[model samples]
Target: MDDLPRRPINKEREVDVNLQVASLLGTNGQWDVTKLIHLFPENEVTRILHMQVGNVHDRDVWAYSPHGSYTVKSGYTLATKLKEAEAVRDASEFVEVLELKRLIWKVPTIPKIHIERLNTRGLELDTCCRICKAAGESIEHALFNCTMAQEAWNQRSLTDLLTAYLKFMPDETIPFAQRKAIPWILWAIWKNINMLLYADTQESITIQIVHGMNEEEKKWVPPLPGYVKCNIHSNWRNAKLHSGVDYIIRDQSGNVLHHARDALTFSPNRVTSELSCLVWTLEIGFYFKDIIEAVKKPNDWPLFRALLQLISSLCARFRSVAFEVESSASNQIAREIAKSVLCDGHFQSYLAFGGPAWLHQRILREAAPISS
Candidate 1:
């Protein structure tokens, strides 16, 4: 206290800091996404909510890689795979096949001999090949090298499918994960072989990866009769405030009505970015006037407590105007546009336009068989 003078702290500065703290309830106590340009990403919040679903037992799985178990080697391998995959023609297809990645990552397969490694703890399980008996029972040996199982891989249907799938892929440049759908089938087969070797099971069945993709597809949904649907997407870079926002509007019958995408002027956090995109999307809908009926967004739309009230406000504005959420995957156009705005620094806008040319091709591809 000897040579120090005490004065009151600046109350205005305190209030300013509090306001900048980024609240769902706006500065004046209103919900506004643009005002709080910094929020957590929606997917992150969704995963958290999913975890909070309260399991009888808690389980943790690594999300960044396909194996659900993270390691330094796996991370490095995944980073390289992602970098290389960005250039691959069918890279999207590879992502759809997690089983394939789990099988191939770090080459967890035949030549490496997973069975011997399993017995390293001294389980005393026989290492001899169940099929050929010439060598140890390893993944590769059981699948291909073994004289008996060799015919399974050599089956005309499997070979023909592999040949047809590979005809569209480059042999040298593309990573093996992106090469063919055959690996998923092979991995399924490998898993069954292990079940027979270790677990007590009987049937040897085949699963076609290509056919399964079509069977379990969850693509964008069209609006119901007398309604208009819109998809929204947002992206925020880690450790940075700048974010990208995108939205696409379509009629009930699935005709594109309008679309717009832009980079945010401020870095509202990821959750905030998505909320802002949702609000911005609705605001744009207010422009469509009488013709606009209802809006449908991704099921993960309302994570924050404030969004429900904000959605309530919109319901009073027009007849049948409601914020509907669904698990259906929307057209990837908004996501593509948002990423483009982030990477290329371009503001994309379309009025009375079908969408970007790239999206048209993607739409066509989605219309075709099997989208990964």
Candidate 2:
């Protein structure tokens, strides 16, 4: 009751401090929206409604760590982040700093080039860019500002194009097709720099970038004989709007057995959206009970906890069903199907026996055997 936000206009109103959480729920076991709005602020009410209710009793859990259990590592990380954030005067500046750190970690390059990491090891080394010899070899210099790196990006015609587009627009606003080569280009630049420094080998950046892109273009593989592979993908736009879930089931021969597209009402976030999709996938698994029984078998928040239990129970019914993660390239069709509902403004849910009519050709192309 102390933590709950009260309605600003009804400051004088009294609330029952002894009110039970169950009392806040409607007969259908969902948050009572009318009651919540009457007692709390609109924003707080929305947060309450978004929470998933479960049959288990509520208990205290740490918020910082996954599985709701706290650890010294998570605690230290939180403290360090809080200390860093406290130094920043503006919230947006803190967010930008965090984003910069995330970008630095995402660069798939040699760790030794980071001056801070090298300094922490008590090693005194030259900080100049090994290739260009003009600027210090910080992450920014090594990845973007160095002469060699700039030449590679320029060679791919991505320097001005990406800088101009990304400055004014969000990453998602740019089509993935146009920006897919950027990562490979950066990887090639980093690889070239590392080779020049350590291996004394000079590889052509253009050739490396082309080779990496070609390797990543591998298509999806089919399941083994007598087994079915279910490729699932989820699209979560925001907490306020509905999210989409798409799952396609295919046999060993690469024939689409069944597929579904669902527009879920309560996504809230990506984790919840994907978890909901997993639960929905398991529910769909019930339909293939006969096929699964012949095969034989194996093997989160309160909402996540409940979903995990449901998944375990579902797995028990099957003779042998395993979950494997595939890259976005391999599951491109499923990803596209999931994105279609949100993109086309079709909020309805549907299940079909074969591949989607609109994507039939693309599906056939994806299912085709690769030529040697």
Q: Model 1 scores what on Cα lDDT?
A: 0.54
Weakest 10 consecutive residues of candidate 1 by summed lDDT: 48-57
What digit string (tens of lDDT, one per residue) describes model 2 on residues 207-301? 88778877788678888878888899988988888888889988866788889998988766676778778778878778767312111221124
lDDT of each structure? 0.54, 0.72
Q: Please give, for residues 256-355, the per-residue lDDT of candidate 1 as tens digits.
A: 6667877664532455556556666666666666301112332222223244335446555657665545333444666777788878877655444566
Best-fitting candidate, measured by lDDT? Answer: 2
How far in Å is the alpha carbon of 348 misplaced in model 1? 7.5
- Please state the error at residue 104 of candidate 1 in Å: 23
